[model samples]
Target chain A: MKDIWKKFDETEPSHSSIHHLMAVYHLHKKNGYARGIDIANYLNITRGSVSITLTKLRDKNYLTEDENKFYHLTEQGQQLVNSALSKRHIVKRFFSEVLQLPAEVAELDACKIEHLLSNETGEKLICFMGYYLSEKPEVLNFRLGFRQFKYQCQSVAECRLCESDCFFSGKEISKTG
Target chain B: MKDIWKKFDETEPSHSSIHHLMAVYHLHKKNGYARGIDIANYLNITRGSVSITLTKLRDKNYLTEDENKFYHLTEQGQQLVNSALSKRHIVKRFFSEVLQLPAEVAELDACKIEHLLSNETGEKLICFMGYYLSEKPEVLNFRLGFRQFKYQCQSVAECRLCESDCFFSGKEISKTG
Candidate 1:
């Protein structure tokens, strides 16, 4: 584990690099092209700072500039973004489906977690979610159910019809049981 | 999501700091006290390098030195280590109990994951595991069952009597189904 962290520290790009990659992704998604200024503006940093980072990224072969002077992610960059996004999806599913967090909260948490979770744990999460959902598809439904239940119920005791049906009820019982 | 990553970058300590905290933790656990040489030997780094990082940790107030020159983690340091270790526990449980990975692999993965997982995702994983386990205690049983079954069965097709009773059989069918 110590060696793994050290290797990650040595090889993995900094948070700013990830931020740049994501900024490029979001900028491209928004405007169909990512410009250096667009990345800077999106990140709330200076254009010169973005340019420096972009230059480093290009030197590292993670980005390229076209004839139109628009920034684009290379295959390596795309893979890095895709891998991070994949981890986010697994974590978001765990949050929304398994823990029944709100969609927005799940999305936000996933973004934070994607960078932090190891590849092994990320793959395990994907497998576990697949296995758990196969066994209990209702867990996937818990997101919508939780929202509706939260809106309807003033308190747990008030939901008389939801005694056995409510997802959170089981959790409450488990705490005491 | 972007803001969260930026915030973590600004506030979170470097990887070396985390490594030092972990070294101190392990040394204290193994020897009842941590010293500079112990940290250096444990990390396979020079005592000078250890001193530099430890000085930074001390400046950051993560460690304290006693009159006997033994090192100890401060409350804040203990909290940080505990939090990271807690994340490891959740990931390890998911790998071993949910995905049925080997114990050593799970441990290694957990150690790697502990550093990567966000607090939000860590908390959610804890809740998800609790909820999932409460709903299906068989997942816990599957851990032990898998070890025994792994020793007995040569391959998936070789398990005759273990068809429906096998833990991973359902997972395999689910994958193809």
Candidate 2:
């Protein structure tokens, strides 16, 4: 558990890099071509940083540019964006539909982690959400009971949910984020 | 959705930095004082790099050093770790307990996103898990039924679980990550 976070650096097409790839995706979809300035505008990043990132992407074999400076995703780049969007889809549905959180919260949270979640987790989440949302009698009963139920953790020691720290009382600290 | 990934920069106590703080936290718990070398060893980072990160942390006012160079978390630093740990706890339980993913996968996935999730999602997940875990007949029935359920997607167009790309069939791309 203590070491898992380190693997984040090993992930391909990291959260920001995926978006850099995705900017190409969305821009190509919107206008059929993506330039460095166009990607910079799309991501709201400065041209200098975007060029550095794009150069890294190109050097890594994820994308390519034509003589006209028109950028395009290679097969690898397209797959990264596709996989990220798929992960985002399931994550958003789980947060919004099964948990019944607001749509905005779900979208924001999913967007933040689209590329970070592992493929196995993404696959399982898709399966779990599909199973949970089925219109079976048990699913219906559980949903109704869940809405009427309230969760109250009396103490950090007794609370299985917060075995580490008490977020319930961390109102002051949460404000810092 | 395109803009949300950029906000990751706005988040303080970033994923790797949180571990720097956590190294201080665990070292303090284990040794009553954290030195520059202690944190570097704890995080597997080189002393030169850890010094740079620790100095930045001090500059940001999240931690401090004393005459002996022992490290300590300020009130704000402690809160950040507390919140991140709390978030990690709930996320782990959600994946391992409620979603019933493998424990190793859950732990890995949760660690990857511990410092990235919003406060709202963390709180809601805790409440939802509490409600879902309650010992009610509806809950039991649903749990039994969910394990028996299977999720099958015929195509991307027909699958609500996969809105953007077909992860179900993307066996080739998943290995890239």
Q: Which residue pairs clash within candidate 2?
A: none
- List where candidate 1 sits over 4 angstroms from the true fold: A101-105, A116-124, A131-177, B101-109, B115-124, B131-177
RMSD of each: 10.9, 4.1
Q: Report the C-alpha lDDT of model 1 over B39-137, residue by residue, as the tens digit.
A: 988878899999988888988899998898788999888777766766776677777766666676677656654655555555556555554354344
**Comparing to the true complex, what docking class would candidate 2 get?**
medium
**TM-score of chain A, all candidates:** 0.67, 0.85
Q: Provide the overall lDDT of each model, using Cα atoms, as 2-decimal numbers.
A: 0.64, 0.79
On DockQ, the leading prediction is: 2
lDDT of 2 at B83: 79
What does the lDDT come to for candidate 1?
0.64
Worst 10 residues of 1 chain A by lDDT: A168-177
